[model samples]
Target: MRNGKTIEEKIFKILTGVACYSLIAILGYIIFIIFRKGFSYLTIEMITQLPTGGYYYGGEGGVLNAIAGSLYIAGGATLIALILGVPAALYINSHLIRHKKTQNTVRYILDSLWGIPSIVYGAFGFTLMIWLGMSASLMAGIITVAFLITPIVIRSFDEVLSTIPKGLHEASLALGSTRSQTAFKVLLKQGFSGLITAVLLAFGRGIGDAASVLFTAGYTDLIPTNLDEPAATLPLSIFFQLSSPIPAVRERAYAAAAILTIIVLIISLSARFFAKRYSKSNLK
Candidate 1:
């Protein structure tokens, strides 16, 4: 009986190991394919040149304008999200909301926004921007992306905030720190690692997002010389060019896709670095 039980345990361990290895192998294979097919088009031209007339024109004239627009929009949204979402997360997690009904209502709104489709967000942004007389503009794209990313940041930050121990808050009070200081100085400082992760996650999503900003942030391909002007992003440019009938146009699209992939990879790696630095520094 003892030998039989030991054999059963070994079998279970082996199966678990095989399952984990298989999952990792599958993911690695997919990434390999993507890199093989999509990386060759990443060129200096693809990074610097603007899109023109359904074709990517000139060497070293890649997606610079699109990349700039994407950064600007994502940055603007991230700034706005931090201003509102972080404090809200702190307030809610710290139980500063005395009214149960109001807190519940606000939580529901954030959660519901997460469930809404990305296309709907774009459509709504276009309608709102046009009604405001801006049409398809960079600011419109920023606001639309901001709205989509805000709920995610709020959710992530709230979870991080919740992890702060009750003992920490109580100790802060014992040291004569007021409620505000306890939250802002004590809780936030301690939760900094998680907050950094939240920001990075939101940024990654914002930069990669295509559908929600497409209609509002009209693809103009020209450099975004002014806030009120229409401009193309890498993702939007890829979409428009990919639909073209010409082979050169499609090649340009492929190149743009490769560049976009590189941009996303950069952002993701940066996020990991940030998370690691903050986590290690704060852990001590």
Candidate 2:
């Protein structure tokens, strides 16, 4: 019996290690490929200048418009998601804390939404845009991406808030504090790191998702100055460029992919740093 148990443990441990290393190896290979193919083409000109008339045909222009547009759309979407998600998450963990069934139902629905394909959101956004007599533009993309990521924000924050001790809530109420006060003053502070992490995760998702913005963003070569103007994004830029028959254009697609990967890496690192800092501060 003892020997069997030891063999089982060893097998599981080996499997887990294999799985972990496999993921790491895959990620490393992806990064390697992107940089290896893109580093030569990822010039300052590509970062600074807008696409020339023949840019897609291996012309002398950069993807600055796409970069700026991606930032604008993702930033706006994240802001909207944060505004809506935080309150919903707080309500679930605070106001509905006692109603396990309701909380589970809400979370299940959110999880289902999260599993839906980005392309579906894009299609729905396109339909809604036509219904509202709105053209595909930065505003439409922002709204669509916001809808895609809000469930993620709510669920991530709710999971963090749920980990908190219920005793704290009871104690606060016992001390004559209102539920609202306890939620904002105590729970919010305790879960600050998680909130930041959730927001950053949602931002990363919004920025990287091409399918969700494909129809709604309506690509343009120029940076959009208004919400009503069409926008370009890195993912879409990569998609279009990679589809080109020109070898140069294909290489530039890899470069664009590299840029997108770097942005996501930055967001991920920022999340970790902020989460750690706030967690330590909360401890102090």
Give the top-scoring candidate (lDDT): 2
lDDT per residue for candidate 2 within 134-231, as digits (tens), equals: 99999999999999999999998888889888988888889999878888888888888999999999999999999989999999999999999999
Full-model lDDT for every candidate: 0.78, 0.91
Stretches of model 1 off by over 4 angstroms after superposition: 1-26, 52-60, 97-109, 277-279
Candidate 1's TM-score reads 0.82
Cα-based lDDT at residue 10, candidate 1: 100
| Inter-residue clash pairs, candidate 2 | none
User: Per-residue CA lDDT of candidate 1, range 162-278, in tens?
Assistant: 666678878888999877878889878988878888898888788878998988888765778777887677778778768877766667677777767767788778767766766
Provide backbone clash counts, one per model: 7, 0
Q: What is the TM-score of each candidate against the true structure?
A: 0.82, 0.90
Q: State which candidate has the highest TM-score.
A: 2
lDDT of 2 at 123: 96
Clashing pairs in 1: 45-60, 45-61, 45-62, 46-62, 46-63, 49-61, 49-62
